[model samples]
Target: MDLRTANMEKNWQLLAGGDRQGLYACFDLFYDDLFRLGVSLYRDVDLVQDAINELFLELWKIRERLGEVRNIQQYVITIYKRVLYKSRHVRQEFASLDECIEMPQSSYEEALIAIQTDERRKALLQQALQQLSERQRQMVQMRYYEGRGFREIAETTGLTERTVYNTLHNALQALRKGMERVE
Candidate 1:
């Protein structure tokens, strides 16, 4: 392993051993470098920040595997790269770095208000889903909530692949129009 990876392994061990301060220190050290790489690809500052947040979230989620990561920088870079790759593959590439939206920090009460707003939106979506036909609901749930590909949904539902694809597309368009009306 490289020297950086060796140091990372040590940090991972420390973190797994409950040394949170050490983990945070390592995170701070790597954050700027990783963010630069993410920004280089994504161009959007929010995407850069989101990529870092997701990378860190994945790191913590797979903490048990951290010790196996010989190259800490490599691991973090891979996370950001994979995120960018996925975003591009999913057709969600950011428009531009200059177009990044900045969210202002809110006080405790405002945070609670924001949380309630999010809850209402989620409830609205749930209500909309409930209004979908059984087939539409199943397709939506499979494609999104369960993260299945069209081919996979076809296999599961015994529908032809084209039928599954068309159903999902139409269902999503309907959902978009429905949400527009609600909004």
Candidate 2:
């Protein structure tokens, strides 16, 4: 393993073992990457920073229960995405009353329908994700969620570029088939 990966793994193990410095080390190592990911997903610097802070706090609270993680970045990122998305949803829910009142009834109705449709699509996508094998799911997330190129994925995953491509291709096909079945 490379020095960076080795360092992350060591810190991950230390965090699991109840070392506060390990947690600090991990936060320092991953903060920038996570911040970039958060901003890319939501485009709100404050919200992204808040989400990252919350994520580390939660991790520290649950450190002992985390057990072994094969890939620390991927694991933390998956949790971070959930936290960021949930935060965004909560913010939307508390939007100003005046804003709601200012919208016309027809426009409000259309917005509600659009939101419902989006919810349905999200549910369908979740179901599709569940159908994929663990490896395929990882590849899909790295490629789409983290926006990593195939070569980067291959290097990080220790898979050949061709294998990464094939895995992602098959994953997309499976997702397409699953969505088609639903439609």
Candidate 3:
């Protein structure tokens, strides 16, 4: 009837007919809406993207059986919501150590382990920071330890904002590799 509705029906038919291009077209058309809905429901970008990916994968798997529907958009959204609901329901909440009565000793042990782990992580991070070049290290310290913004760091160091960003990016990559080696 209408252009949007007509397009949806055509795409749905193509999908039902096992046309991969149609599936891609449908993804292109609905991806933004699905992303928005998933984010609103789940509040995690990675989770939302994963859900969308899984949803599309499942749709492709069942494309042949996917019969005609009055509203393709609504149909896809319903599936997305169902997938999210099942994922959300499957999670088991763990009580904090403070909330558990029987594990006080275990809690203390866990706390000690956590503190040691944090110290080791800090030491590794410091080592990684030291591996950075002088200019890169200065940029990182100004941005992170000094709590200065990129613009402020650039102003103080007499570098452009883009240069400051590039320096930080390279520094972070090096730190990541160094930390991985430490791990």
Candidate 4:
């Protein structure tokens, strides 16, 4: 085996054998690159850091059972991707609840109140949306309110598809937080 692969195999064995220093060494080798990947994928440094920390903690917990990883770098990245996916799924679920709340049917008097309530909700949402940067607000409006696809938004806005997705993701995150505060 090559030198780096050999070194990684040795470190993996040591970690699986429960060597504390070997665990630290593995972390030192992998954390920075993993953090960079996480940040690029998630767009939130704090959330990425939390994901990395949780990933290492889980790795430590299950190290003994992890068994014979051929490539430690790939293995760690696979685990990290899973963690990031789960984190994103959770955030989307909670944010969807806040952003897409449903209303029930009511009588005329209640309907009038509902109309006023809807107006207030729209004002609150507008205030929340205003807090985002102009680019983010535009991306969000195009994607969510205007019913444009990412590719269409990209074409119209002169941004790449990935850039549109990232901008809308950050915008939605900010809108969720702002709406929470407004409510």
Winner by TM-score = 2
Q: Write the per-residue lDDT of candidate 3 for residues 1-183, one digit (tens) a residue.
A: 888778877887898899998888888878878877876666655556777888888889998787756668788999999877766555313545567465223333454466579899999999998899999999888988999999999899999999999999999999999999989
The lDDT of model 3 is 0.81
- Residues 1-183, model 4: lDDT tens digits: 787667777777788888887788778778778866876675655567778888888888999876677667888999999998888787667776558655443444454465578898899899998899999988888888899999999999898999999888888888889888888
Better of 2 and 3 by TM-score: 2
Q: Which parts of model 3 have CA positions greater than 4 angstroms off?
A: 90-183
Least lDDT summed over 10 consecutive residues: which range in candidate 3?
Answer: 103-112
lDDT of 2: 0.86
Model 3: what TM-score? 0.49
Error of 4 at 32 (Å): 1.3
Error of 4 at 34 (Å): 0.4
All candidates in order of lDDT, best leading: 2, 3, 4, 1
What's the C-alpha lDDT at position 146 in model 1? 95
TM-score of each: 0.43, 0.52, 0.49, 0.49
Which of candidates 1 and 2 reaches a greater lDDT?
A: 2
Which residue ranges in model 2 land beyond 4 Å of their true spot? 97-183
Better of 1 and 4 by lDDT: 4
RMSD of each: 11.4, 15.8, 15.4, 19.4
Model 2 residue 78 lDDT score: 96
Q: Show pairs that collide, candidate 3.
A: none
